[model samples]
Every structure is written in structure tokens, then in C-alpha cells.
Target: MNIYSDLPDSHTLGLEMYQLISDLYPICRSITGDGVRKTLHVLQQFIPLEIHEVPTGTQVFDWTIPKEWNVRDAYVKNNQGIKVIDFQKSNLHLLNYSIPLHETMPLSKLKEHLFTIPEYPDWIPYRTSYYEENWAFA
Candidate 1:
């Protein structure tokens, strides 16, 4: 009676893990948002999680809790009216927890805020400005 013998094969387990990642990869998770709640909800299906919520502006250590951010849509368009970056195509196109703003700026100015990984030029970098009041797109 070996419990190990009842487990799925390595290949099957790998496929299941990959499928789970694929399902969760696209979720727009942040420090606080429906995305985070949704992710926790999905995870709760596998393991019990005690979800807790602290009111905005609650003091924690040296910093006060900032407002929770959630974006429904965001994008940047060139002067000619073509979308240069669209959140719809990829959430990476928008910085996480970005304070919503709609403004037209020159490409040079916008480039100042853009971040990229020189080592992984083709990869969309994961970035966040949790404590700072700023935003950027990878």
C-alpha cells in the first residue's frame, strides 16, 4: 500500500501544472483589486485562504496603505492616432497600480517612463511602484 503509486504520471502532472499556469498567467493581479481577490478565490479551490482587507490609509509601519488601483482599460496612441501600446493586447503594456490618467505626450517624454530588460529584450518585465507615486510600462 504505497501512496506514491496512486499519483499521476510525471508527464500528466507537468501538463496539469502548465494548464494551471496558462489559466492564471493573464489575470491582472495587483496588491489590491478584483484581480487579487479573484486569484485568491481560484487558489482557495485548492487550499483554504483567509482573505483580509485593511481600510485605505491604514498606517502600517512607516507607510500608510495607499489606495487600491484597478484599471478596466488603458492604452497609448501615437500622434497619428495609432495605438502604440494597448493594455487589451497585453496587461504588460500598462504599469501595475498606475493612477488613471489620460493625457497626450510626446514619444520622447513617454520613453522616459518606459522600462525594459536589456538582458531580455523580448520579454515583458514585471515591475511595480508600490510605495512610490509613479507609473511605467514595460
Candidate 2:
């Protein structure tokens, strides 16, 4: 299947919308409680929304909002334990919903879950966890 078709365009209009969204992006925004409330407040100005929030441990369907994955930083080190890539430098460097692992592993073991795009191997692919436990570079 061609996944690129599902990707958003990076053209002029798309870029403009992206810039607008970026300008309004609230980093460190929590998904529950006040964070969500504040977001709804801002969103209401654009489109009225009835706010509803499920607490941290509530289950719905086959999924539950996993404990807010608010990561401050993460990174990988080489065999010598020297830092290779740091999440503080770029959030995409760490896998979202990763279980806060800090130990070092050989490349072979880490490769099992790592993801890379051949077109942009160095670029971190946007990955999110809404249902399952997974960790990956992409």
C-alpha cells in the first residue's frame, strides 16, 4: 500500500496551514484536566466544542489513554556509552510511549523495533501510541 497518499501535502496552502497550527501549538499541554480545558477554551474560539475528558486509567473499547507520555528527554548511546542522538535535541528521536528505558543495548537488539525511512533515513518519522506499547526511532 502507498502510505504517502495518506500524508499531508507540503505545498503553499498546506504550508500556510502548518504555520498557523505551529503558531498555535501548545507544547507541554496535558491531555487531561486543565491542559485539556485550556485547549478547549482556545479551540472554542474557532469552533464550539463540548469538552469531555476521560481520566488517566479509564478504558474505552480496546484502548485506554495510556498514562500521559510526557517525556522530558531520551537518547541512545553507542557501544562506548557516548550519546548518539538525544530526545531533548529533538522529540522525534525518542519513541513515543517508550517505557522510559535508559540502559544501552547492542545495535542488533535495538534494530528489532527501530524504524527508518530510506528516503530520509536520518529523519525521525512521526510515531504515536494510542493503543499499544511500542518503541521505535520512527
Candidate 3:
């Protein structure tokens, strides 16, 4: 096989890859959500794809497929009613597969559910609860 002839130029492929990343960066993707479907559809344009459907409880050997999880929106607002951690701006701010929650609580109580990395003030932390029924801001 002629590897050189089969592949696009490195520079061209790099640009295409970068463009694909740019197009997908805004999607609030998780283990299962419309964002994932959108991403797959985008890639479907470039190659052939065969999708498979498996029920949430289906067992494969010793493992069971968990529920398809998706989060619509999540945020934490200050007492003044201003959002301090808005998931809409950056989906990473919310914990992945977090259970739905909407409530008002004191900072002491809310801090229990707020995860962070003090070392990196500018970067949002990534957290998830695929097995636990819980909620938190990352």
C-alpha cells in the first residue's frame, strides 16, 4: 500500500482536524446526549458509520449498560441572584451525569456539592457521577 498516496498532506489533515475540533467545542457532550449524536453525525459526513442500539439494562458478559444520561442545564447563583458558575458558558463547570437539582441553599451547604481545583484558578475541573445519584458543580 502507498501510505503517502492514501493520506492527505499532513498540513491539510491538521487543518481539517482543527476545524472539526472547533465545530465540536461548543457541544455539551457527556457519556450520552444529543451532543454525542451531533458529533457522530458530523463525522458521518466523512466516513461510513453503522450505529448500534442497546437497552440500558442489557448485559454483555459481566457488565450492564447503564442509563443514557443527559443534563439540560445547571448553574449556581449567588445570593444576589447572579450566576457564579454557569454550565451554559462552560459545560465542564457542571459534574457529568449529575442528577437534576434546583434549589436555594447557604454557601456552607452548597460548598458540599461544589468541586474545584484551587491550583488552577482559570481551568474548570472535570467531575462525574455515572453510578451515584448525585449532583455537583465542577
Candidate 4:
């Protein structure tokens, strides 16, 4: 009666999906940037995806497109010079749409911008400041 009942084993399909996710998980993706382009390119290998690059300042509805923000690298180091959070390890370490900055600040000051879900302390949250003039790290 159900079309899904005629499909292959769910375990096999789940394994295949997990493999696909593992292959693509490391890509750094943002609303607009080379990361997004690279992600789409990888996805295109398995599926047909049409990508369009709208120029900055283009108007859509009542909002104008913001300039593309592409990050090559970002990190936060402790006062002792050990990197506590490195984007190279995971893109999630860097805040979305963060402007380029390199400065040494005390942990007390930095903590103000850090976010965490108390209910899931071990999990990192994906954050974005696409329209706000601010930055945050998860």
C-alpha cells in the first residue's frame, strides 16, 4: 500500500546517507561566498543544483543584498597563546558574517559574545548574524 514499503532496506539507505553527509560535512558554507559555491559544487556531483550569484546591492523585495563575506581563517587563543577555538578544526567555531578582526582580548570580554545551549552543552550551535552588525561564536 505504501511506496516506501517497496524500497530497499532502511538500514542500507541510512548508511548511504551517512556516508554522503560525512563526505560533505567539512565544507565551510555561508549565505554568500566561495564556501557556498564549493558546497554546491560538491552537491552537484550527486544531484542537479542550479546556482546563481546575485551581485551585491541587488534588490529583492524590500531588502538589498549585502556584500559577500568569505572567511579564509579565524581563531581565538587563550592568554597563554593556545588556540581555544580554531576555525580550521571546524567552521562552526567562527561566527557567521564576522568581519575580519585580529585582536587580543581578555576572556571576560570575549565571554560576552560566546553562546551555548545549556541544555546541550556538548553540542555546538550554528549561529548567524546576516542582518545584524554583530558577531558571535558558538
By lDDT, the best candidate is 3
Over the stretch 2-119, how does candidate 2's per-residue lDDT look in tens digits?
9788766679668877765774463434444454566677668768798776777788897676576666667777878787776756666666666666666778988886777889
Q: How many pairs collide in each candidate, listed in order?
A: 0, 0, 0, 0
Q: What order do candidates take by lDDT, descending?
A: 3, 4, 1, 2
lDDT of 4 by residue, 11-130 (tens): 998998898888778888877888889888888997999988899889999988887878888888887889878888888987788777777778888898897889998778888887
* Model 2 residue pairs with clashes: none
lDDT of 1 by residue, 4-103 (tens): 9989999999998898888777888887777888888888886889999888899989878767878798888887889877788788877787777778
- Model 2 residue runs over 4 Å out of place are 1-52, 59-63
Give model 2 RMSD, 1 decimal. 9.4
For each candidate, what is the lDDT?
A: 0.82, 0.66, 0.84, 0.83
- Runs in model 1 lying further than 4 Å from the true structure: 61-63
Q: TM-scores for all candidates?
A: 0.83, 0.58, 0.87, 0.81
On residues 40-80, what C-alpha lDDT tens digit does candidate 3 reach at each position?
88989888997666777888898877678776788999988
Q: Runs in model 4 with CA error above 4 Å? A: 1-13
Q: List the residue pairs that clash in candidate 4.
A: none
**Could you tell me how far off, in angstroms, the CA of residue 119 lies in candidate 1 after the best superposition?**
5.4
Candidate 2: minimum summed lDDT over ten consecutive residues — where? 26-35
